[model samples]
Each structure stands twice: as structure tokens, then as C-alpha cells.
Target: MSLRDRVISTSVESSADPVELLSLKNPVHFLALGFGSGLAPKAPGTFGTLAALPLVWLLIQPGLWFYLCLTLIACLAGAWICGHAARDMGVHDHAAIVWDEVAGMLLTMFAVPLNWSTLLVGFVLFRLLDILKPWPISYLDKHVHGGVGIMADDILAGILACVGMHLLLEMGWLT
Candidate 1:
């Protein structure tokens, strides 16, 4: 089959098995929240971000540098993995591939304290920036393609979210 056909076929749903949904052996499966968020007919990205929260919370306590490093790794790896998966499935940046969200949230919380308010703000900001895709992010999203294209905009959004979160924290606005 052609590459595009493969991508489209990979995204097709036949069953609702949770195990099958979460399996990432195929890069696409690994990315689409194991297909969990992908299965959602509405707001899959939001669900994907929410699904990543627990992991992001756990990673945040290791220190800002560690989280930043992890986020970077995820972004880099996600580009490859998500891209491969998308190609395998005959698609581009599938909704089920939420590793981008995980990486983005990690970026958002990089320097922020681990608290509900901070987490909430980071979540809102990251999601808003990701969805809005402003400035360089929007530019990158339009101009870039492939694995880098899949992951670039979200990474930029994460950076923006991190900046916004830090500002809010510094100003004591979140407390």
C-alpha cells in the first residue's frame, strides 16, 4: 500500500479493547494515548493532555532542569515516534498521539512549583497556547513537516506556557 493509505488505515478503529488501545509498540499506538484519547469522538487532545497529567506531576518534583530535559527528550523522541506511527498508519499527527501533550505539559511546568493552582494554570495556558498556535508556533506548524513538524509547534507552546506560568508564580498571582 502507499504511505498515505497506510496512515489512514492505521487510524481505523475496529474494537475497544483497552489493552490494544494503550499499546505503543507501533509508534502510532504509543502516541495516541494507547488509542484511548484517540477513541474519544470529541476533544481528543484535551483528554490526551488530561491523561498525561499524573505522569507530568510525578516528573515535576525531580527539579526544573530534570523536567526540562525530560520534556526535550520526549519532544525529540515524539517527533520520530509520532511521525513513524503516522506514516505507518497513513496519517499525519494523529489525534491519538498525545506524547506531544506530555512533552508540552512538562515544558509548561518546568520551573513552576508542584501545586494544584500552578498545575491548573500551566494546564490551561499550555492547552490554550497549543490550540491557538500563535506566532512562531503557528508559523512552524504551517511551514515545517515530518517528525519535526509534528512536534515543533507543541514544544513552542510548552515554552510559552512555561513562561506564562513562571510569570504568574513570580507575581504571586496563582497563590
Candidate 2:
């Protein structure tokens, strides 16, 4: 269903806590919650980003085409996963729904050489951009709606981080 339809069709009381509604058994929720990493009581997004490390390691192994294709698939599919989970929880971009972070981290590390320093830099950069939400990123977060809305800001943050990583590489600041 469209985000507008879901919003109009459901009424979540302000007093009602939506976290209780999340069920990991539900595959949609499982993926949306970053394989349960998003369930962390504090900084779920951080934890969710951390959970992406293994994925980053794995994606970096194959050539760029494979990595890019898989990451693209995740980003596209994540939109549906996140939107469906939000609809189920009756919340918009709930903290527990962090598949966007997973996708963001994937994008952040794209094509960057796998190493401790690069990994750390990408992580910090993506997280900072995601949290600070500057300019166009902030604009997309506030203005966009539905699955696209939930994923747009993070995607941009990931792209920006990816660019930063490339810059660091080209500048010989990181190797």
C-alpha cells in the first residue's frame, strides 16, 4: 500500500509503544531491523551499522560488479522491507527499522580497499552524515515519504561517504 494509505488507514496512539509490535520471526521485520541489530536499546542505528561490517567484508571480496549489483539489490529491496515494517509497526521510520543503515554502510564502503583504517573512516563518515543530516540529505529526510523517504537520506549519506573514501584514497591519506 502507498504510504498515504497506510498512514490514513492506521491510527497509532501516541502513548502506544511500537517496539513491542516488532516480531523477529517475521522475515520482513527481521530484514528491516537489520537482523535484530536495530533492537538495541540505545543507538540502534550505530549497532545496525556495526552489524553491516560482516556484509561489507563479504561484499568487498568479489569484483566491483558483483559488489555493486548486490548492494544495489539490497538498497532497492530495503525500501520495501523498511516501508512494510513501518506500516506493520504503525510508525514512520521507527528507530528499530534500520535496514537503511545496512544499505548505507554497504554504499559507504563500495570499491574502497578493505582495511582497518578505511573501514573505520567509512563507518565514521557515514554515521556522521546520517546523524547530522546536512542540507540536501536533511531535505530528503524531512520531505520525502514512504519507503523512498526512509532510504533516501541514508543512501545520500552512503554516497557522500563513498566519495569521501575515494578522495582519501586518491589523496594518499589512506592506503
Deviation (Å) of 140 in candidate 2: 0.3
Q: RMSD, each candidate, Å?
A: 4.0, 2.7
Off by over 4 Å in 2: 1-16
Which residue segments of model 1 deviate by more than 4 Å? Answer: 1-28, 32-35
Show the colliding residue pairs in model 2: none
Candidate whose TM-score is highest:
2
Tens digits of per-residue lDDT, candidate 1, 1-175, equal 8755643554465433323323555545656453356556677778777776787877767777777777777888888776765566555676766667777887788767787887887889999999988899899889988878878888899889989887887888985
lDDT tens digits, residue span 7-116, model 2: 44444445456766678998998999999999999999999999999999987787889999999999999899999888877789999899999999999999898989
Instruction: State, as a TM-score between 0 and 1, how close model 1 is to the true structure.
Output: 0.81
Distance from true position, residue 89, model 2, in Å?
Answer: 0.6
Candidate closest to the true structure, highest lDDT? 2
